[model samples]
Structures are given as C-alpha cells and as structure tokens.
Target: MIYNEISKVIDNKEIAENIFEAHLSSDNLSKIAKPGQFINILPSSSFDKTMRRPMSLSYQDSNSFKIIYKPIGDGTRIMRSWKEGDSADIIGPLGNAWEVSKNKEAILLGGGVGIAPILNLYNNIESTHPSHLFFGARKKEEHFIDHNPDKNIYISTDDGSAGIKGNLFEAMKSIFDINDFKDKSIYVCGPPMMMEAVRKFSVEHDIECHLALETIMACGIGICQGCTVEKCSDESSTDTYRNKYELVCMDGPIYKANEVKTCLL
Candidate 1:
C-alpha cells in the first residue's frame, strides 16, 4: 500500500447523526482513478483504530478526490475531529471500477450507504448511457441527497418519507413496467438483499447487470481472503466465488451482477 497524506479537508456537514463527509485531496491517486473504485482510510497512529476503513472516492476534479463517510466507531470519530493540517493514510484508486461499455442504456441501483460507489459509477456513465437510478433508504433523511442527480433519479423510503411508498425493488419494477424499457444493462450497489432483488429483476427482463458488492473486507487487497462470493453456475462448474474465497479489497468491491451469489444474505 502506497501511503498518502490528507492534503485538504473541506465542507463538514452532518447529513445524519453519525453520517458525515470528509473531502480530501490526493491528486496523484485521482488522476488514475476510474469509477467504482475506493480508497482505504487510516487515521493517525496515535489514534486508537488500527484497521483502515474503505470509503468510495466520491468526486474528483483535476487535482484531487473526496470521500463521503460516516463516523461510526472510535476511528472515524477521531478522524472527524481532525483539522485541515492533520494526516491520514490512503491506499487506493484500488480494485476494478465500473465498466461503461457500448450498451445504450443502463439502470443504476443503490441502497443506503451503498449509494457512494454507485453514484460515482453513474457519473461516469450517465451522459453516454441513458440511465435510471433507483435508491432505497431507511427514511427520507438517509436518501443521500448529495449524490442524487437531476436526470431520471428515483427514490423509495421505508417510512414513506420519500418518492415511492415502498421498497426500492418494488419502485424499480414499477418504473420499468410503466416506461417499457427493454434490453438495457444494469448496475447495482446496496444491501445484499437489494442486490439479490436486482439480480432477480435482471433475470426476469433479460437485462445485463453489474453489481458493486458491499461485503466486509479486512485487507482491501487479495491477502485476507475474508470476503468472498459464489460465482454463477448451474452445476458449480467454476470455482470463482466465495467457494475459493476471493478478497473484496483486491479482487472486487464491484462484480458482475450475475457473478456473485446472494443466498447467504
């Protein structure tokens, strides 16, 4: 892991009680980064946390990238209290980014905190591919208002505080059924249940889909072998997924929609 320092910290806001954003600059990393990739973040050595937390590269310009995160534990809590001059270690633009191929249209699905990577993926594909974004959140407050773009963005909240009356999957089905979209590609990132639902919908409609998996990762690289998923096969012919234990950090945080199994979740 190539260690880097946090150059700039700007715009601190509490979207929710624990949910916050830390925008940092690492120009070298951002120059080579693509969509669907993430950066592992580590607070100071004096801090209590030893493990690095992975956060998606939220936005980038010519010089740097940013991360949207939540202060969930002691580590993030310490990081959130840091000032502009403080230092943090980062290791990315790592793993495979979302592939925006020649497909004319694609559907982007996001749930809860899962929206981070999906938002970046959407920005990369939106202009070229006609796309629809369907997001599910706990309530209207958790909808991640920062990432929702103006074009074709749809939302659903469990408490009926947002766009639709029910879950994200149901809202997705309703949008597709009403609009008569066909033969499009799909990209999904969310809870495992939501990913499973997306897989089912894609199968039913014969839509090609990709998924950004949100499984736990210990090493953000191929070493730990902690995060794995079963590959798609009727007969278990291939040994690609959790069967062999692929690392989420190195191999993928984003995988082919049909490539990984969701049965465990």
Candidate 2:
C-alpha cells in the first residue's frame, strides 16, 4: 500500500562530502517499505517547488526510515537545511522492491548517490545470505562506506585513490571469473553508464541481474505519466495507440535486467 503523510524529521546531518543523511519518523511507511523502494519528499510546505524529490530508502526500522542524498539542486539544497522537528510532506514506499533470490549468492553494485538503494538491499539481505558489495565513486573521499575488515565489500574509484583504480567492473573482474558468478544474483543501482556496463556484462555472461533505475519524477505516481521507460518486450504488445512504456514511479525502480532496455535515466 502507498502512503501520503507528513513525516517528522528525527535527525538530519551531513555524513560524507556533500552527502546528507536524514531520519524521518513514520510508522506505517517504515513497516511496509522494502529494499529498492523510495520516498518522494517535498522540500518545503509552500508551492515554491511543486514537484516532490524522490529519494531511495537507505535504511529503515520500526518507527523511522533513513534517506541518504546529495544536494545537487535547489530542491535538494532546501532539503539539506531541514533539521530536527521539521515536518516533510511525503508520499511513499513507491515502486517495487528487489526480488531477492534466496538460493543464490548476491552481488550488489552501487555508485555515487545511487548507493542508497543498493545499501538498502544489502542491509536487508546480508544477514542471512552470502552477499558481496562492489561500490564505486569518482574519488576516494566520495565513498560513504568506510574501510571495514569484516564486510565482504570492495571499493573502486575513477582515480587511483581507492581500492581498484578503474570502475566497478574492473574490481569485479579482478576478483571473480564468469564461472564464479554462476550461482549468484546481481543487483545494481548507479549512474547510467555504470548500470549500462553492468547490464551488458550480465547479458554477455548469462548472469541474473536486477537494476534499480533512477529518473526525473514529477508526481511520484502514475498520474503524471512523466517517468516512462520503453519496455523491452514492446514487440509483443497489442496496444498500438500507446507505446509500450512503463511508468518508473509506479511499475518499477526495480526491474529484472532482461525485462527492460539498459541505460535508463
């Protein structure tokens, strides 16, 4: 079920370089929210910004949920100024959750701020399952996860400042061959290029892959018809008047890699 509520801010602070983490109290939203689902939050109560900003859920418990984001524009910049006791008009638990495979090992890939959903997926699955995380960023300082010896985590940066010098694919290639991932399921959320590369690689190797897509959203619901992605199976569609496009906000943010075309924005 979807919810529209005025959630109260429990805590808000900058955790990394330009990245802010905020916790909002919402009992219903928190309980039903799943990995790869997101919330749409209005920066202010007034009509200065009509469109709400969509943010992926990074963590959640019984009474509150956490969102990690980078303030890249006016809406998010206003969100950065939000503090404790502030009320945010939000709609959420939108989009589908990741279809986690219980029998297979899991491989999670994330980049930059896209790590929000990936982290959420990991936190949900890592406890009882075997999971590996491959996280990438432009620079070493841009990464949110600190170096920890206990986690099955790998890091890569564009510059040679972090673990692997190249992209996430490079880091994955160094550790495992195609045969090593035969029994694994891959989940990815990141920039367009990164997701595209992973999609191609997954197809080439016949690996099972799922992607959490990111796009500009207006309504965060299907009413606006603003966030549509071309469906991969359009050739079989019977509807000729309308193109075979799915709304990202309602139908997905999570889709099987083979179910949609790659390089989704």
Candidate 3:
C-alpha cells in the first residue's frame, strides 16, 4: 500500500447535480498506476468509516491525478472540503488491467458512475486503437462526453435530454450494432444489469466482449473479497474457471463480459 498527501485541488464543481470533478496532484501513486486500475481513499478521521472508498483513476500525468465523483456521505463531503494543498491518503493501482488484444476497432461502453474507469482506459488506449466511446445517463443534463467529440464519441440519454435519448446499449446499437463491428471487440463498465444487457447484445452480434466489474469494496486490495465476481465456461471467457469466484480487487474490477453472473439479470 502506498500513501500520499494532496499537492493541489484545481477544480471543484458540479459536473452534474451531485457529481463533481476534483483534480488533485499526487506524484506518489500516479507514477505507478495503470489505465483501468483504481485507488482506495481513506478519510482523515478513522472514526468516520471502517474502510477506504474506491474511486477510479480518471486521468493522470507525471505529477497529478484527476477523479470525477458524486458526493455520497461524510467521507465524500469531507473530500470536498480539501483545498489546493491538503493530504489525501490513497492505496493502489489495484486490480487486473485490460489486456490489449489483437483486435483493432474497440467499443468502450459505460454509464452513470461506472464510466470512471474507462475514462482513463480511453486516455491510455485511444492512441493504440480506433475507440468508439458510448456513454449514457438518465438525462441530457447528466451527459458528459468529455471535452472532445469525434466519430468515436456517441451519447444517449433516458429522458431525451441529449443524444439518442435511450440507454447506452441502445446508443451503441444506434451507431453500429454487433454486425457493424465485424470482428471488433467491446469493453464495458457499468451497473451490472446494464453490463448484462450489453453482454447479450455483444454475444448475439458475435463481437468479443470484456467488462470492468465494479462492486462495493471495503478493502480495495484482495483481503475483503467484497468485490468478488464469478466466472464461467463460455466462448467469450473460455479460460475462466466454471465454478470458482475471482476476487475483483486482485484479479479484476475489469473482467471478460461473458464471465459474470448478475443477480439482477
């Protein structure tokens, strides 16, 4: 576990109603983190919470890190109180990263808070492949397609506030469904039900699919098994153990799309 103090907090604003984007400088962890991994944040007071909260590594440079978050409690509220120079404790680049395969064109899908991990995935892999980013939210008011748009950036919303006015699976199909990508691969990160729907779509369309699994984690490292997800024998994740559980903290947070089993669907 690695620890550090905040060197700066550049922006603090409502990215959405309760959502915020906080840019902090942490030379310590940024140097070692990979694209699809995350960090565990510890509140200043141990009396507040028993464990650290997990947040994705949105973007980072040599001396800084940026995260987009929604205020959830005293912990997040306290994080908002941090100024330009303060201390923020962090642990890890914990989890299995997305392994770049032989595929060329890749579809990166995400929605709601699940979009965090893929933001950095895009930053790291966009240059290596032709990435089409499909994002969805409840309304156009919540749509954040980043600062740049391209043939790759597509958006949709549930309330018709923005792009396609539907969910991300629909947003993706609207552009080019499974048949469109031919042999293209897909990477997904989102609510479990949403991922399940995307997984079905990818399978029906004959596209390869991978998922970034996000679950409640008391310990962002392997100890707690709070983030464990199951694997199964399938065409998509052929190497997955049929009846075994994989710890999302150590083995994943990002998993092959077919390996997961969801309680919702």
Candidate 4:
C-alpha cells in the first residue's frame, strides 16, 4: 500500500563520513514495509525542489522505518539537515520485495549506499538461512558499518585500504568459486557497473540472480514516465522491436538479472 503521511523523524545521525541514517516513526508505513521497498520523501523545508527524493527502506520494525543515504545533491542535502521531531511528507512503501526459496543457498551482495536495502534482506533471511554479505566500499572509512553480530561479512575496497584489494565482484569471485554455485540464489544491489559485472557472472555460471536497480526518478510512482530500464522483449510476436522498456518505479527496483538488459558490459 502507498501512503502519503506526515512522519515524524525519531532519530537522525551520521553513521559514517557523509553517510546518514534517519529513523522515522510511522506506524502505518512501517507496518506494510518490506525489504527492497522505498519511500519518496518530500523535502518540506526545501520548497524550491518540487520532486520528492526516493530512499530505500534500510530497516523497519512495527513502529518505525529507517533510511540510510548520502547527501549528494540539493534534495538530499536538505534532508540531511532535517532534525529529529521534524515532520516530513512521505509516500511509500513503494516497489517490489525480494523473494527467496528455502531450498537454495543465498548470497547477499551490495556496494556503497546500495547496502542499505541489502541489510534489511540479510536481517530477514539470516536466522533460518545460510547467507553471507559481500560489502564493498571505496576506502576503509567508507565501510560504515558499526558492528555485525553475525560475522558473516566480507569487505572489499577500491583501494587496498580495506578487506580485499579490488572490487566486490573480484572479492566475490575469489571467495566463492563460480563453478561451485549451481543452485544458489544471489541477491545484489550496487552501482550499475558493479551490478552489470555481477549479472554477467551469474549468467555465465547459470546461477539464479536478482538485482535491486537504482535510477533517477521524479515520481516514486509511475506517473512521471521516468526511471525506465530496457528489458528484453518477452512477447512471441517478433515484429521488429528487440527490447521493451519498464519503469523502475512501477515494474521494479527489483528484477531478475536475466529479465533485464542490464549486463551488456
């Protein structure tokens, strides 16, 4: 269900350098919220910006939901300055959720701010399932996680300052052999380049892979005709169109790696 409500900010703090986490108290929004779903936050204070900024639900409970983000632009910068007890207009629990089968082993992959949603997925599946997180960052300080009780984490840095010397894809390839994962499921969220690499790797190995995609969205819903991703045509009628397009806001932020034309690189 989509909600447009005035939600009170319970807590807002910087967990890492330039990365902030905000906890908003909204019983209605949090109730139906799921991992991979997101909220469109309207910066009430910044009336100059007309569009809402879309943020993924990082953590959620019965009474509240959390979002982790970096203030990259004006919209998010305004959001960063917002203090606790401030009420903001928000529309969510938008987008699709991840679906996992109990029979297969799952691997959770995320890079940078993309790890926000992956964290939620890990929390839900870690208890009963065999899962691990391969997190990537540009440097050691950028690897912002305070603690991990599960200890099922693998870190990768672009520079050699952290866990693995290379990127997440390389770390993933080295840690787990592609040949060994025949029936495993991979849940990944990252930059498009990283996701493309993961998608290709999954395809080459014949592994079932799902991706949480990110794109520029003016509206969180499908009204704006924005955030379209190219997808391979599913129809049998072969007229001339080789590919179709889908809205990231409406059709997904979550899609099977095979279903979209994301990994051409």
Candidate 5:
C-alpha cells in the first residue's frame, strides 16, 4: 500500500564524495518498500520548492528506511541540512520493483548515484541467490566499493582511476566469458547511456534484463502525467494506454529492457 506521512530522520551522513545517505523512521512504509521502489520527499515545508524530490529507497528494515542521494539541486541542497530528529513529509513506497528471477543467477549493474536501488536489491537477494555487481563511476572517489568480502564485486571508472578503469561492459568482459551470463538475469540502474548500452548487449545475448529508470518527476504518483516516455511500437496497446507512451511514475521506474523504445531520453 502507498502512504503519505511525516517521517522522522534517524540518521544522515555523507557516505561518498558528494553522496549522502539518510535514514528515516517509518514503520509501515519501510515494511513494504521494495528494492526498486522510490519515495517523494518534501525537503522542507517552505514554499521555495513546491515539488517534492523523488528518491530511490536504498535500504529498509523493520522500522526505518534509507535514501542515498547527491545534493546537486535546490531541493536536495536543503535536504543536506536535515539532521536526526527532523521530520520530512514523504510519500512512498512508490512504483514497481525489480522482478528477480529465482531460477537464474542475477547480474547487477549500477552507475553513478543510480547505485542506490541496485544496492538495495543486492542486499535483499544476495543471501539466498547468487548475484554479481558491476559498479561504474567517473572517478575513484565517486564509487561505493564496500561490500561483503565474499560477494562478487566488480568496479570500473571512466578515467581508469579505479578497478578496470573503463566502462561496465569492459569490466564485465575482463572477468566473465559470454557463457558466464548464459542463464543470468541482468538488472541495471544507471545513466541513460549506460542503460542503453546494457540493453543492447542484453538483447544481443538474448538475456533477460530489467532497467530501473531515472527521470524527473513532478509527482511521485501517476496524477501529473509528467514522467512519460515513448513506448515501443510493438508493445500491445491497452484501452487505457494506447497513446504510445508510458508514465514512468506509474507504469514503471522499472521496465524490461525490451519493453521500452529507448532509455537515452
């Protein structure tokens, strides 16, 4: 179920270069927040920023949840000042979640701040399912590399500052043969270019792949119709959705790689 309420901050700290992780207390909300779902948070009660900021849920426990973000915008800039004991108006657990396959090994990819949701998925499924993570960033400092010692972790940076010093595909190719992905399900959350590349690679290999999209949202719910993306022409036209477009806030934040025309928009 969806919820709109005031949640208190439990902790907020800078985890990486410009990335900040905030823990919020929300018993019921946390209980239902899935790996790919997101929340819209009002950074402050003031009218300076009318629209709430949509953020992915990075982690969740029994009584609280976490959001990891970079304070690069006005709303998020205000969010940086928020401390423990502060209250935030939030609406969540929104959007569809990653449909993980129990039968196939999971290959996860995350780029930049998009790693938040991917990390959430990894935390939830790594214990029982075999999973691998390929994380990429522009520089060494921007990457979040801390993980369980036993977990399969791969790293890449555009500038060769860390790990493979290349893109995700480069990193993957170095350690994994094409056959290694034979029965694996790929899940990705990243910049449009990265997602598009992964989508093409997945299609070429005929592997099952899912993408968690990042787009500007006027409303976290489907009400505003502001987060629309062109649908693939081959997608079946439903009576209520025959317009050749899909609302990212409602229909997805998550979609099968082949289901959408392109993520480059």
Candidate 6:
C-alpha cells in the first residue's frame, strides 16, 4: 500500500560534498516502508518540473524515513535549500522490496547512488543471517556515505583512492572465494554498465542474483509506461521468445538477474 502525506522535514543537511540527506517525519508513511522500496516526492520548488521525483528510501526508523540524494539539477537543487520545518507531499512506500530466505547468506553489491537501498536491506538481514557488502564509486571523494567497516563491508574506487582500485565486482573477487558465491543470494542495485557487469558475473557463476533497476519515471504508478524493461524467460533463453516490455514501477524496480535482459538496454 502507498501513503500520500504532507510530511515535515525533521532534519536536512549535507552528509557529503554534493549529497544532501533529508529526514522526514510521518506517522503513516514510515510504518509500511520496506527495504528496496522508494518514495515519489512532490517538489515544492522547480515549478517547471511537472512530475514528482522518485527517491529511494535510504534510512528508516519507527517514526520517520530518510533519503540521501545529490542536488545535481533544478529540482534537487531546490530541494537542497529546503529547511527543516518545510513540508512536502510524498507518496510511498512504493515498488517491490528485497527479501531473504532463512539460513541464506546475503551478498550486497551497490554502486554510486544505488547504495541507497542496501542500508535498509542490511539492517533487516544483519542479525538474522550473515551478510556482506561491496560498494563502488567513481572516486574516493564520492565515498562519503557511512557504513560499518567492521561488518564485512568492502569498497572499490575507480581511482584507487580508497579500498580496491576497481569496481565492486572486482572488490568482491579480491576478498572472497568466487566458488562460494553459488550458495549465496546476491542483491545488486547500480548503474547500467555496472549492473551488466554484475549480471554477467552472476550468470557465469550460476549464482542467485537480484537487481534493482533505476530509470526515468513520470507517474511512477505504471500508467506512464515510461520505465519499461525487456523481460527474458531465463538466463540461457535466447531471442526466439518474443520480447515483452515490463513496467519497472509496477512489475519491479527489483527483479531476478536472470529474469530480465540486462545486457540489451
């Protein structure tokens, strides 16, 4: 279920160089929010922008939720200037969420802003099962987000500024035995190129991989038909099956890696 509410910004500040973290207080919205779900926020500024921006749920407690974003454009720049008392109408908790089965180990792979959802996923699986995180960014400057280093979290920077001098998958290969991945459930959410690399690795290794895809959305309710992705029958299935377009908003922002054609688009 989705809740539309005018929620107050409890706190707002820059957590990193260009990234701003905003905490919102809402009674009804926070209760139903789950890991991997996102919220559509109505911009109070940016009059020219007609549609709400979809921001992933970065952190959530019992009474409030939070989102971490970069003010890269007109809408987000305006959002950055918003004060704590300001209110915005947000619709959430939207999209399908991530899940883990009993006794199954989890491997989280995130790149760039795709790291947003993993925080929630980690919190859920932390005490229940063993979980590991692999994060990647373009540079060390972009690695401003916080995570427990003690909790088996590894990082890779493109410039070798921080941990491994490669991508998240490369970081993974350097740390753990690739053969052990077959028994683990991998969750990935990142850019297209990065996700493609992860998808290829997962397929080749015959691992259980789930991916969170990001795309431009308008309605965010599947009515806009804006975020369509090609659906594949299985990892080994060929083009002989007729291509089908699935709406990311409704069908998923989260999907099994083998169930979709990640390399095509």
What's the TM-score of every candidate structure? 0.86, 0.95, 0.87, 0.93, 0.93, 0.91
Model 3, residue 258: C-alpha shift (Å) = 2.2
Please tell me which model should have the higher lDDT, number 4 or number 5. 5
Per-residue lDDT of 66-156 in model 3, one digit per residue for the tens? 8877777877887777666666777666777776666667788878877777778888888778888887788867766742355678777
The TM-score of predicted model 1 comes to: 0.86
In model 6, how large is the Cα lDDT of residue 65?
89
Error in Å for residue 1 of model 5? 1.3
Off by over 4 Å in 6: 145-150, 234-243, 263-265
Cα miss at 238, model 4 (Å)? 5.4
The TM-score ranking, best first, is 2, 5, 4, 6, 3, 1
> Over the stretch 137-221, how does candidate 1's per-residue lDDT look in tens digits?
8787776663344668888887888787677778777777723645567787777777788787676666677878767666766
Q: Pairs clashing in candidate 5? A: none
Evaluated against the true structure, the overall lDDT of model 4 is 0.83
In model 1, state the lDDT of residue 146: 38
Model 5, residue 66: what's the lDDT?
Answer: 89
Better of 1 and 3 by TM-score: 3
lDDT of 2 by residue, 1-265 (tens): 8898888999999887788999989968889999999999886787387788999999999889999889999888877999899999888889999999999999888888888899988999889999999888888888777644257798888996977788877777777888998999899988888888888888888899998999888988789888888767768668652357778898999888777776656
Candidate 6, residue 246: lDDT: 75
Worst 10 residues of 4 by lDDT: 234-243
| Candidate 6: residue 53 lDDT (0-100) | 89
Which candidate number maximizes TM-score?
Answer: 2
| lDDT of the candidates, in the order given | 0.70, 0.86, 0.73, 0.83, 0.86, 0.81
Backbone clashes in candidate 2 total 0
lDDT of 2: 0.86
